[model samples]
Target: MLSTPISLPTVFVGAAIIFLFALALYPSSLLRWFQRKRYQYEVTFSLYMLTPTEKFIFNSILFLFLAMVSIAVALYLPRHVRIIAHRAYYYVSGDLVKNGTTSAVLGTTAEILTPTTVAEAIGSA
Candidate 1:
């Protein structure tokens, strides 16, 4: 059986379909997100009426949020990328596993999906 390489747009559409299916299964989650966004938009984030202390407090909270995000990206982003690349490499370029023998794509997906692999990935970063 010849396997055609999936195009980028096709992959994106498939992903979107899967995402929509998930949302369909748990629609309240999506609705809650929309509701949260609506509520969030109701609040005006301005430093205009703030006293010096309030401004400092607001800036501190903003800085902390940004710092945490930066730290998470610095720490986890590389590991996440490495895991995906590692899995893709194994998937695209090795001996193929026989079917009914696996729930994973090549039996390798399950092999690489271990917590050990994830931990190893995290440790390398």
Candidate 2:
């Protein structure tokens, strides 16, 4: 059976229909968001009283939150990447053996002796 790809206009029409249906069902929700009043919070420091604008506080919070998240990712991502890469290396080794290609050299060595046994043997010597 031949499959036909949906066109761009078809997707737009479907989206429009869904949007109109949602608008019909809950028109107030959209209006509530658009017509909502901005909330302001005052921060009092010892030197100065600052009443930051809603947008400024929101932007600052967003920026600081994202910055912290980025820093955390930078600190932790390498460990995860190294673990995944190590697993992938072993998986590729097994695949190479199955495919009758040159088996990974490290994989052959690992098969001869488990890592802990090899470490203990080496340490005893």
Candidate 3:
């Protein structure tokens, strides 16, 4: 049996649901995982052992770096991923052969059988 193709939005929504479920059910485990994973490398220079002013500056820099990375992935990566996935689906499904068009455009379904013969319709106000 042929499987139905999942849309990009469906994939994202399903992922978000799983993420939320994990957060709700396993909050302590997630925290433990973070604590276990962190500080794996030997601290040549320790952030935790810094003076108050130095700690604040180090935290500020770290926060900025995290924010930049998050924003870059959130803003740009989805659209890029979707375009690539759609192209891959096109090749895999042979949608061009079956549908005789690429992905559906967001508009009316009425077919344009012929080009309209245009008369000069602009009137001086």
Candidate 4:
């Protein structure tokens, strides 16, 4: 009989890793696509509710949650590895945010104002 080089576990592990990587990179693309699809014609709102720091924190939290759940499911259901991998990828990369343009504007504004604050006046002015 011919020798089988790759085992099922190895394949599953590789798929899981790829899924996680995709998830990590999905946020920005997914968010942008979602906004374009759903609110393409609508007037954009302000990002007054969340700062860039808050946005990053929120995205990180979401990514962590997805990673945890994906890992848990993958560990518990080895046979359904493919399904778990797909779900994890989708969840991780899926767009959870709606208005990215507003956030961009807010971030830009913050950047612009940050250097003009009174704290910088002592040295520059």
Shift of residue 85 alpha carbon in model 1, Å = 0.7
Q: For residues 5-79, could you state the per-residue lDDT of candidate 1 as single tens digits?
A: 879999999999999898888878769899777556435665656787987898799889999999999999987
Among all windows of ten consecutive residues in candidate 3, which has the lowest summed lDDT?
116-125
lDDT of 1: 0.66
Q: Candidates sorted by TM-score, descending order?
A: 3, 1, 2, 4
Tell me the lDDT of model 4 at 88. Answer: 64
RMSD of each: 22.3, 13.8, 20.0, 26.8
lDDT of 2 by residue, 12-33 (tens): 9999999989887786865766
Best by TM-score: 3
Is 2 or 4 the stronger prediction by lDDT?
2
Candidate 1 residue 122 Cα shift, in angstroms, is: 23
Q: Which numbered prediction scores highest in lDDT against the true structure?
A: 1
Q: What TM-score does prediction 3 earn?
A: 0.40
* Stretches > 4 Å off in candidate 3: 1-45, 97-125
**Tens digits of lDDT, candidate 3, 34-112:** 7665554215447557787987787789889999999999999998887777778768864432322232432223443
Q: How close is candidate 2 to the true structure, as a TM-score?
A: 0.36
Query: Candidate 1: lDDT of 71?
Result: 100
Clashes of each: 0, 0, 0, 0
Residue 111's lDDT in candidate 2: 38
Candidates' TM-scores? 0.39, 0.36, 0.40, 0.28
